[model samples]
Each structure stands twice: as structure tokens, then as C-alpha cells.
Target: MSLSEEPIAPTPTTQQDAPSGFEETESVNTSMQEFHQLYQKLLVITLVLTGIIFISVWIFYSLNTALNYLIGACTGVVYLKMLAKDVEQLGAEKNRLSKNRFALFVGLIVLATQWHDLHVLPIFLGFLTYKATLLVYTVQTAFISDS
Candidate 1:
């Protein structure tokens, strides 16, 4: 048979072809994984720092004192604010609320574990209230903007 009568197999892609894993879906998934890693790092750091500060303050001052409680509560709130801002600055604005919500939930759990004997009920309750309020606000804003 003549050469032209034979079946031809497809040639492999040349170097100019993009890498196999460089497709759009893979790129998007990689971006999301990167963000997830960053968020986990931030959260771990935040929790460690919060625990250190809380224990140091408790060791130096009476947890039942109004002033000490005020300082601790405010410090926790400020830490939350800072965490939110840092996440936003890291280009996690789309996930800010969810991150904050999760962090707050964990913080409250940690607080319960560490301060269960210090009459810190008010602070825990207050922090939860604040977080819930923010959650409601975020949902409201999202809905309103969607409409």
C-alpha cells in the first residue's frame, strides 16, 4: 500500500502547549487552596497569641476584677478586629465574615476552657452576642445588596 493509505496517529503536544495541570479549573482550585492554607496559618497564630495574652493577664491580675475583665474582654474584641482586618488585607474580603465567625466560635470555646472558673460568663456571653450580631448584619447586607 502507498504511504498515504496508512492510518496516521496524533502527534504529542509540543513545548509551546501549556502544561497538563495549567487548565482553568486547576488554576482556580490552586488559588482556593492557597487561600485556605493562608487562613489556617492566620487562625493558628491568632489563637496562640490570644491564649498567651489571656493567660498572662490572668496570672498578673485578678480575673474577677472589673478592670481586668474589661481589659481582657476588650483585648479579645480587638484581637478579633485585627484578625478580620488582616484577613481582608490578605485579599480574603470575600471570606472575611466566615473566617471571623469561625474564629469567634473557636475563641469562645477556648475561653470556656480557660476561664471556666473565673466568672467570665459575662465576657463569653458578650462576645457571642457581638459575633451573632455581626453575622446577622452580614447576612442582611448580602441580601440587600443582592436585591
Candidate 2:
């Protein structure tokens, strides 16, 4: 029979026999998984530091200020988490979304500052804790070995 007219037989394939494109996709998934794990680790560190700061503020400052700090820290964490998800889903649109997020964050800070009852300093520090945690984690990963 001519190649075009011949009936093709099905062939069984194993995982190792996957196409190059499939292999590349698998690697991408693995890297994304690693990134997610690192993100969670950073989040946990940020929360713990936030808790410590909240406790200190509660002891040294007024209850309203302490609550504001907690609120700010939680807001920052939620913002970062949402941003990460947005980046993953939007891919090419990340740059635009990032700029939008920065504008939103700055607007929130300005609003908080204008609210006379809310202590701006603690709120600003709490907002910064998320980035500080990420920086510390990145430095640790780059400079420290598991061994």
C-alpha cells in the first residue's frame, strides 16, 4: 500500500518516550512548582515577622496602632499573593499589572497617612515587611547551602 493509503497501527508509549515539547512543558511545571513552594516559604516568614512586630507594637503603643499594623501587614501579604497569581495567569500583561498594583499601593498609603487616627509609621513598616522578607529569603537562597 502507498504510505498515504496505508492503515496506521497504534503504538504504546511510555513516559520516557514523551515528545520534546511535552518534556519542556514538564520542566516548566516543575519550575513553577518550585517557585510556588518558595513563595509559600516567604509568605510564612513575612507573617511570622508581622506577628512579632504586632506583638511589640501592642506592648509599646496603643491598641489602635497595633491593629493598624496588623491590618497593613495582612493587606501587604494579600497584595503580594494576588500579584503572584496575576503574574502567573497574565504572563505578558504582568508589567502593566505591576504598575497598576504600585499605584494602588501608593494610593492606599496616602489614604492611610491622611487618616489621622491611623499611625502612618507602623502601617508603612508593615507594608514594607513583605518585600523585606522576600529579599532576606532570596539572599539566603543565593548565599547559603543546604549542607
Candidate 3:
């Protein structure tokens, strides 16, 4: 018989050689912990940036404008939290993102247009604070080395 015709015997695997359910669970738990930590860090950074900018705007601009900005900033925070929750649910509890968070922005814009005290410019700019935070964090992670 030729070498190609020879039957190959399967090597038996030991129980210790295979990954256990506990190990799989531990790895998943570790991944979730890391995700939560990243989410918390992003949230904290966004809040700090919002506070600093809000104070500066209040100092340089009118209280009405500051209040409008605050309203938008708070909405942005809520929208971000909702978005994060949706992201966490992706592939687990949800197949797609929820659009309810976007209603917050639309409501803010509609209110701004109808209200006498609120201006669209400041509110829109304030709403962009979250995007700025995400951009800065992306840049920081890309260029800065972790020690």
C-alpha cells in the first residue's frame, strides 16, 4: 500500500487540553469589564469638557445663551448615554440602533426655533461637544503611547 492509501489515526485529546466553560465565561466577563471601563472613561471625559466649556461660555456670553447651551449639552449627554446603551445591546439584545435618541436633537431644534430666548447656533455647537470629545479621544489613543 502507498503512503496516500494508509489510514491516519486521530490523536485523542485530553480533557485538560480543551477549553472549559469556566474559562470561556471568564474571558467574556473580562471583555465586558473592559468595555464598561472604556464607556465610563468616555462619559467622564465628555462631562468634564462640557462643564469647562459651559463655564467659559457663561463668563463670556449671556446667561440666556449659557442656559440654552446647557440644555443642548444635557441633551447631548442623554443622547450619548442612549447611544451607548444601544451599542452595548447590538448583536445581543438589538439588531439595529434605536432612533429615539435622535428625537431628542429634533425636539431641541424645534424648541430653539420656536422659543424667543434660545438660539440655534449655540445649541447646535453645544450639541457637537460630544463629537469633539470622541474626536479628541480617538486622536489621543492613536498618537499617544500607553505606558
Best by TM-score: 3
lDDT by residue for model 1 over 1-147, one digit each (tens)? 899999997665763465665576677678778866654554555445445545665677655544344544554556566665565555434533344545654675576568645445545543433344355556766998999
Task: Note the Cα lDDT for every prediction shown.
Answer: 0.55, 0.80, 0.85
Tell me the TM-score of model 3: 0.80
Q: Which window of ten consecutive residues has the lowest lDDT sum in model 1? A: 125-134
lDDT (Cα) of model 3: 0.85
lDDT of 3 by residue, 16-114 (tens): 555688568787789888988888988888899889889999999888888788888888888889988988888778899989988999999999999
Model 3: weakest 10-residue lDDT segment is 10-19
| Candidate 2 to truth, TM | 0.77
Each candidate structure's TM-score, on Cα atoms with residue i matched to residue i, is 0.39, 0.77, 0.80
Candidate 3 ranges with C-alpha deviation above 4 Å: 1-23
What global local distance difference test value does model 1 have?
0.55
